[model samples]
Target: MEYSKHNIFSKVKDSDEYFLLNPLSMQADILNSVEAQRYKDKRIENQQEYFKKGYLVDPKAEEKLFKSKYLDFIDERDSDEIQLFFTPWYTCNFDCSYCFQDEYTNPDEKVSDAVMDAFFAYIDTQFADRKKYITIFGGEPFLNTPDRRASIQKIIDGANQRNLDIAAVTNGYQLEEFIDILKGARVREIQVTLDGTHEVHDKRRMLKGGKGSFDKITKGIDLLLKEKIPVNLRMVVDKDNIDNLLNLARFAIEKGWTKSPFFKTALGRNYELHHCQTNNKRLFSRIEMYQEIYDLVKTNPEILEFHKPAFSISKFIFENGELPSPLFDSCSGTKTEWAFDYTGKIYSCTATVGNVGDELGTFYPKVDLKQDLIEEWEERDVLSIPECASCNVKLACGGGCAAVAKSRTGKIQSADCRPIKELLELGIGLYSKHEI
Candidate 1:
């Protein structure tokens, strides 16, 4: 296969037929190469810069470097250009304990009309000559609020009328009600989370009446299916919900979703930060969990066909020789898209908004999509950020989840890079055992 060794647009070259090298051997190649040495020197210089910026590193040693074009994908931060986000309203009925925007004023405070008008106007001016997308989000988008629903309808109507792409990230509570409204809305994708089964999910995500919400949610999901909406189920994997994942996967497949064109599975990390609920905390044993899931897939190949394997985890294990979270490689709100709150505030990722200091900026009047602001949002001086610069996998990780890194470690400079490194090492061993 032809590969670009570094940047995606770099010169493509052919290699003679040769045996596959394990990750360790590849790392050895990286360390011995002049290019790799230059990368290391640059990395050290960046670390000094990070330290000067008040970032600190842990006592842990850095992982060995590996050579893989996969890391290049993370570094390709320049591909996407245009972006759009639609916040229907902040009136979700279910109160997920870990919700970052849980503290935002309820429906009463949302500028329902102004936001809709501004969004439509913004879309007209901003999206006229550039590729654009519309991402629908909210507290619980399907609430009984007329204004919220109206705003969402306008965006949907506008997008459809203009032949624009649309996607929604919702709690799935009112999915059924909104299904009909969205049927002709030019929506291409929808993401909804199912943390676990009824028992666990109900406790963590309940209604305003403090009632378990699994049944209604399932009903709403069925409603979505009836409307033929393309959907991907996002599961927030953590210590608490890990054990039940296999069963959850099985349940989804049994729903005749195995062969459904819309079927996809997204594994998420549990950032156990303040105000975030931790009821089902012990979701996985990290490495052990990866092993279990991998073994399960090997044992039941059908599951892989039924549900798209969690691409993030699989990439970390088989490709990157690392595992940060199941969805580590996903470009949340940055790469292909971004998030906007009901109040018209823009963020790189929805999860990082309320937590990541004053780094986030407002998008009310209008924000330029062609500027370098997106990359600047998480800029780290490798010389200044000790942990990230010293780590061999920093480029691939981009310093890991900014939210989790901040919430858990109380800083944004250093994140938990150990799990990803270990997973990559384990993957190398597994591949060697299989003679890959």
Candidate 2:
């Protein structure tokens, strides 16, 4: 018997106690110095318990277990539920400074009735065996014009006919105009971005003509909450807006937005995707972003009332009170999720949705697929990646984002590894102080 390769051990700050996390089993054990030493020495072992906990393992047996778990994770990808992201247009009203979609040409191409017909036809025939739902994507799905609103209604109507639930990622500029349509449809949740306080948010998320959008967006959020429609408030964080995060949190609390059960919030790292946005210099790395949030939470605990920064490890611990289940894959690309742009071009995931060369195939007019490329993406997971297979924290990291990997290494087969040790250390400290 030997120490498991998957075990991650770290000392709790300013204390003799330590945490032993087994990502495979999603278990965490807090141990004192003496206890940790005893376990390491195999002096107080019930061999069976030690083996079961993955504190000690036989080499061959460990390999078998890893293989079994990896296979199970891959097999579970045969999910019955299918999430489809449909882009009605690519022309958003807000011209946020860090908008990654800006890398693609903002074509004025609209979703015509013919396109919608082809889309539904493709779904019926190709995805017939699966349950389906639709997520209306941008350029601003709710653009506030009568013609745009009518187009949205048509998309909603199509989904409603199939008893499909609908969700949308919009700028929330014209949410008021579509309230009636939203109320009628099987609305799931609407995701709207609010970078920071009015000053910060308006500057970052502004109208195309450089007008402030704070008032309009807040009004739209108010309407959604009043109607009890679920709203996920997203904040795109970067160096420019990092300082204002706390102020935004305070604002949300003051407005009682945080207290609403129908509301949820998340922070998106403003980073490069297919190509670097103009604000690349101001972008934060994954670990850097989490560190910023950690510092903010430390200074002002009230921010936790609005939303907790659950960087991967912290999220698992907070949600499950355990380490994290071993992840065979990190993303849903080419698997349970697929993205369909306004032109009927299909891609693996949202990150690659509007990318120039990433289209997996076309779904409209007739069903066409680049099976080789699709299979390549579909087969990607931690177990399948050379670097990920040998990493100690592969379970926690899950090989990082496929999009990031592709962009950085020019290959989807690599891992976009985070600073796992630092992240885990931070997570341990953060969660130790806060219960959730």
Candidate 3:
């Protein structure tokens, strides 16, 4: 027996303790200095408890077991529920500086009855037997216009007819206007982005005519909560607006939104999943973005109320008292998710949906697929990615986002490596008490 390559050790800052996590073994412990050294030393026979817990394994057989477990994971996930995204059109009323869709998704393409009819008809025939749900995605699905509202009505009606509950990803500027239409389907949750407090947010996410959207958006949030519908408040943060998260948190608390069980928060870092926008210098690398949140939490602990990032594995361990199943592939693209647009085009997932070149095929006007491209997306996983083969945290990060991976290396199976070790080290300290 020998120490497993999958074991991860994170040293506690300014202390003699270390956190040991093994994704493969599903085991963890806080190791003191001697224990940490003992783990590194060739004294496996001295640690019977570790042996039983899978920290120690036969070196030759470990790889075979991992591959077997990975197959089980894929089998289970491939049989899981599907999430279907419907993009009505790419037209938007507000102009946000860092919106990734701005370059590819233009306002000229609008949804018509013919397109909606084709989309719903296609999904009904293709996924009639699968356990699936609908997600209304956009340029702006809830825009305040007769035609746009009609599109929402049809989408909600069609999803309801199929007994599929719905979620929506929207800007929330016209949420109040779409409240009735939104209620047409069994609403799961609505994701609305509010980047910062009123003053800060207005400058970045402004209406086409230069009016600030904070007031209208807040009013809409209040309306949704009153209607007993759930709302997830998302903040697209970058260096420019990251500091304002604290202020926004205070505002949410002041508004009593934190009191409601229906309210939740998510932080979307402004980074390149595709090509970047101008002044992309403000973008924080993945770890740097999380590191900023950690610093903000130290400045005012209440920032955690707005967002509690799962920093690798600490939050899970703190809650479940056990390691979760290994993550063989983090990207859900062609596996359990798909996106359709009014243009009759099909995309692998939300991030790459509207971008012209990323389209896998079309759903409307015809039912066709580029099987070669589809196979590439479906084949992404730790085993398929070259960089992940010998990596320590392969099972943890699961090769990261396939869209981001492809953007960087132009290969769907490449690794968009995550700083799993660094994040786990910070996460343990951040979530645990007394710095012990």
**TM-score on alpha carbons, each prediction:** 0.68, 0.95, 0.96
Candidate 1 lDDT: 0.55
The sequence of per-residue lDDT tens digits that candidate 3 reaches over residues 271-371 is 87767678979998889998888778876888777678888777787778788889999999988899998889999899898886899999878889999
Top lDDT hit: 3
Candidate 1 runs further than 4 Å off: 1-76, 81-83, 104-107, 123-130, 274-336, 354-359, 365-375, 378-386, 406-418, 425-436
Model 1 weakest lDDT span, ten residues long: 4-13
Which regions of candidate 2 are displaced past 4 Å?
13-16, 36-49
TM-score of 2: 0.95
Q: Where does the lowest 10-residue lDDT sum fall in candidate 3? A: 427-436
lDDT of each: 0.55, 0.83, 0.86
Q: On residues 1-436, what C-alpha lDDT tens digit does candidate 2 reach at each position?
A: 8888888887764467777887876667788898778876768546687677886778788889888887777666675477899998889888888787886788877888888888888888878888778999988898777778788899899988888999999888888888999998888899999998888888888898999988988999999999999999999888999999889989999988998999999888887776667856898988888888888888888888888876667667866755555777887887888999778799987888888889999977667999999988888888778898678888887887888899989888888887777787777777788777
Superposition TM-score, candidate 1 onto the true structure: 0.68
Candidate 3, number of clashes: 0
The collision pairs in model 3 are: none
Residues 77-180, model 1: lDDT tens digits: 44444557666656677777667566655544555566666766765874466567777766666665676667677778878877887888888887767777
Runs with alpha carbons beyond 4 Å of true place in candidate 3: 43-45, 434-436
